[model samples]
Target: MRWFMWAAVAGAVAAVVLAAVALMFAGGDPEPAGAGSAPAIPAATDAAVSEAAESQVTDAPSASPSSSPSVKPSPRPTLRPMDVIAGLHTTVRELVQDGQLKPDAGEDLTKRLKDAAEKLADGEVDKARDKLEEFGKKVAKLREENKLSSAGYQTLAAGLAQLAALLPSR
Candidate 1:
């Protein structure tokens, strides 16, 4: 037990010394990540005056003290419910054209999806989501009735699930 304690103390001291040395070598402070970022520290004291010759690509040319890029690519846009509905409409059309889905069923599904998209656009999110759920049930029924290929049904069902997921919850 005594030997174990001595070994642990020695290890802790060594770790502390190593960490201090690493921090010193890494520079006094590291830059923080976020919107309000400061200009990068110059590699050398004299390098700051020759920034134009450095050939470094900055986010943008700024006249301000802050060198951080102001405009980040609009935080990756998420699919809206209407967008999902449009995709479903296209999928239904494709399946119909490929003869994997019945023309009548495809037409009906397209109409339902169009209505759902319209409803969502009109601020009827819950109603649109309900319509989408019903549409999914209809797709399942097509599988049960053997009116659609398994693969086609799976694709359609997945699209419906995705669209439903995009809808805002009640």
Candidate 2:
């Protein structure tokens, strides 16, 4: 009986250790939210991003893809770059609207992202992709700089990856 109990405890410990390992493999920034003595969102940037985010919840979900198979419409693009930007924009909007931004020099980087996404949705796939790539790079840079918040860069990277996958094989 004691052996069985020890086995169960060992199993639980193994499970916990495995979960921790998985989380580490999943990749996350070391800093926690509100960890760095700095606010994630700055007031000025938040306001600008919020204004651009007005169209975040787009009335039109999918823009028609080009006829070329390379640009063929995805029957279901789980996380299009535009969609990702739109949702993120909305979050920025709410953050600013809720006065969550700090007086710090941080600027609303969201508007620039939204504009880039609009270029994508407007049938400019190449441009969109370029912009998306740029956005991903920016996100990565911000993360490395410890300027990213709560998996924001990770989500951005995921969105870019989704868009890349949905594209027809070049």
lDDT of each: 0.68, 0.54
TM-score for each model? 0.55, 0.41
Clash pairs, model 2 backbone:
45-107, 45-108
Model 2 local distance difference test score: 0.54
Runs of candidate 2 exceeding 4 Å displacement: 1-81, 91-108, 168-170
Tens digits of per-residue lDDT for model 1, 1-170: 64345435434544553454455446554334654776776566556657755776677976767587675444434556677677678767866776667999998888888777777888988888777877888888887987776656766666566555556667
- Give stretches of model 1 more than 4 Å off: 1-74
Q: lDDT tens digits, residues 8-86, model 2?
A: 5434544553454455456643455576777666456877888878867677778777786554443432435565566
Q: Using alpha carbons, what is the TM-score of model 1?
A: 0.55
